[model samples]
Target: MSPMETGLIGIGALFVLMVLRTPVAFAMLITGYFGMLVLEGSRAAGAVMLTESYSTVSNYNLIVVPMFILLGNIASAAGFSRGLYDAAFAWVGRFRGGLASSSVLGCAIFSAVSGSSVATAITIGKVALPEMKRLGYQDALSTGSIAAGGTLGFLIPPSTGFVLYAILTEQSIGRLFMAGILPGLLLMAAFIGTIALIATINPEAGPRGARVPLGQKFRVLVQSAPLIGIISISIGGIYAGVFTPVEASAIGAGLVLLLAFAMRQLSWNGFCRAILETVRTSAMLYMVVIGANVLNPFLAVTHIPETLGNAMVGLGLGPYGTLAIIILAYVVLGMFLDGLSMLVVTIPIIYPVILQMGFDPIWFGVVAVIVIEMGMITPPVGLNVFVVKGVAQDVPMTTVFKGVMPFLLAMIVSLLLIIIFPQIATLLPDLMFS
Candidate 1:
């Protein structure tokens, strides 16, 4: 049998396993393992896959994963998320849709520190849900805002999804991070704008409240200065070359602990819990990465990606048409796979095709993430929406999905802007890294 036919069966088998509720990591591992045996013989496949797994897991660049996850967990334990929500609410709460707007703003900041969408959704949802409900915001708007905004973590700096994208495409991490900055900011702005528009069309959707006194607002801002400082250190330092992503994460983690102590929020038990959670999350992520390492090579050896890339480019489909198809595919696969898993599984195939189409890898990383972010908000299996709904039980799953619809449109618009003007994604990377 030809390698192509063999590869198709392997993919089919993996999909079947996934549908049957197998863990994504194990499904990929088992299918890839068996695929290799079928195509390359058992002994040869075993030696290659095992050795590759060891080297992949031990890489130094990848150490950033655990530390970044740890930083986010520590920030949560330190009560920093509340500080973010408070800061956002103080200034925005008087406006129509205040809670929903504040949730988006809070999430934008949270994204700077956390790389995972679920972490952002859970953290921000916990802080914002009750307030939104209390303020009489629509259930859909509150839940949707949190669910949609949580995706900012996927594109903002220190994003694990982007990191996985860089690793898969063999691009520079700094460039990928830099390229993502503007696109992520654009998405945030679009989301906020979308909320404002919705509120405007129906005043009841977002009734303006009495503004907080100026003095009180200033005090609230002062309280969140620590979070701002940490964000600046982590994000600003990355762009300015003041620190590598790894060092910035370490600094952020230390600052979270320090701020916790300063605010009298850090307890010994709380600290341990944060550490343990971080370890568990990090271990799970690494396992997925290790599994992908084994799985990706099997796909490569089959020449499937090479064939697909060549055929698509040869078809004379415009770049936009091809990109559209890719986006649709992500929307479907994203409902089933987590963002990191999606990156690992698809980037190996799609990213090469993207580069072959004459696009910058960094810019494509931002675009790809936005598409995956949409998936995170899409129904039936939308992870962020589920996380937010899990925390905000007052809002039904349907309402959450409805609320997120506008933001999903906003994200697509942001993606288009980035797609049309690659420099929006690439300029910062060029300025800093060049």
Candidate 2:
């Protein structure tokens, strides 16, 4: 068979492997290994394929990944979740839909440390759902907000997914990290606006609580000092060039560990749990990555990207039509695939085509992330939504989904706004990273 035909079949096999519940890394690795042998024969495939496993892992920029994940786990275990909720609540919890709004703020801040969406959603849900419920918020709005807000983890700086993207695309991780800042903030703003609109339309969905006392508000703000300090040190250090990405991550992880120990939150058992989970997650991610590295080359050998780029350029459809098709593709795949995997699987194919057609990769990354954000909230396999579902089981899945409807629409509009005004995504990274 032609290498292109074989490559296409390998793609089908990978998808089947995923659906059959094989580990994604294994699926990618096993498929990638044989596919290479099929295309390039035994000796050549063995030489290059063996090297990718460690070489890909050893890149200094990639070290930031585990540090970020460990930092997130430690922060969550160390009471960062409560601190974030308290700070957000002190200011926003008295307004109509206030508790729901607080969930959004909490997720955004939580995302700064915890770049994992499911982790972010589940952690914040445990802390915020009861608070919202006790404050007379409906389960639909409360859980839905937590689920929707969790999607911010990927859009924010320090996103593990974005890190993976930067590595995959060979872009400067710092620049992509900078690009995500404004888009993340914009997404949060859109969520808040949607909450206000919902509360206004149906006040019964969310009822207000009493205003926090001035002194109490200050106290809550004070409680967040550790989080603010850690976040500032880590992100600030990276931006200022005080440390490399890996160094910033390592420093953040160490600080979180010390903070957890000081706060009496880091027990022997919790510490053990954190390390094990980190290893497991890291292994899974690395496996898929190595697979993609091999698989990517295999695809490139087919000239698929070049061929597809030419085909798209040949199409009579204008720019908007191309954009629409890409967006539509994301929405469809999102129903089943998790966001990060979807991005990694699709972007390598789509990006070259995009750049060849004059779309900015940075702008495309933001635009791509926004579409994946929809996946995080969309049903069936929405990872964030499922995390919240695991938290608030009393609420039916449909209601949680229904409650997120307006936010989903708002998220789409946010994407449109970002696309229409490219500056929204580019401004921060351009100005700061400039």
State the lDDT of candidate 1 residue by residue for 158-257, as single tens digits. Answer: 8998777766667777888888788888888898888889899887877675688999899999998887898888878888899887788788888877
Can you list the residue pairs that collide in candidate 1?
A: none
Clashes of each: 0, 0
**Backbone clashes (count) for model 1:** 0
Ten consecutive residues with minimal summed lDDT in candidate 1? 163-172
Model 2 C-alpha lDDT per residue in residues 362-428, reported as the tens digit of each score = 8888888889989988988888777888888888888888877788998988998988999987886
Q: Each candidate's TM vs. the true structure?
A: 0.97, 0.97
Off by over 4 Å in 2: none
What TM-score does candidate 1 reach? 0.97
Off by over 4 Å in 1: none
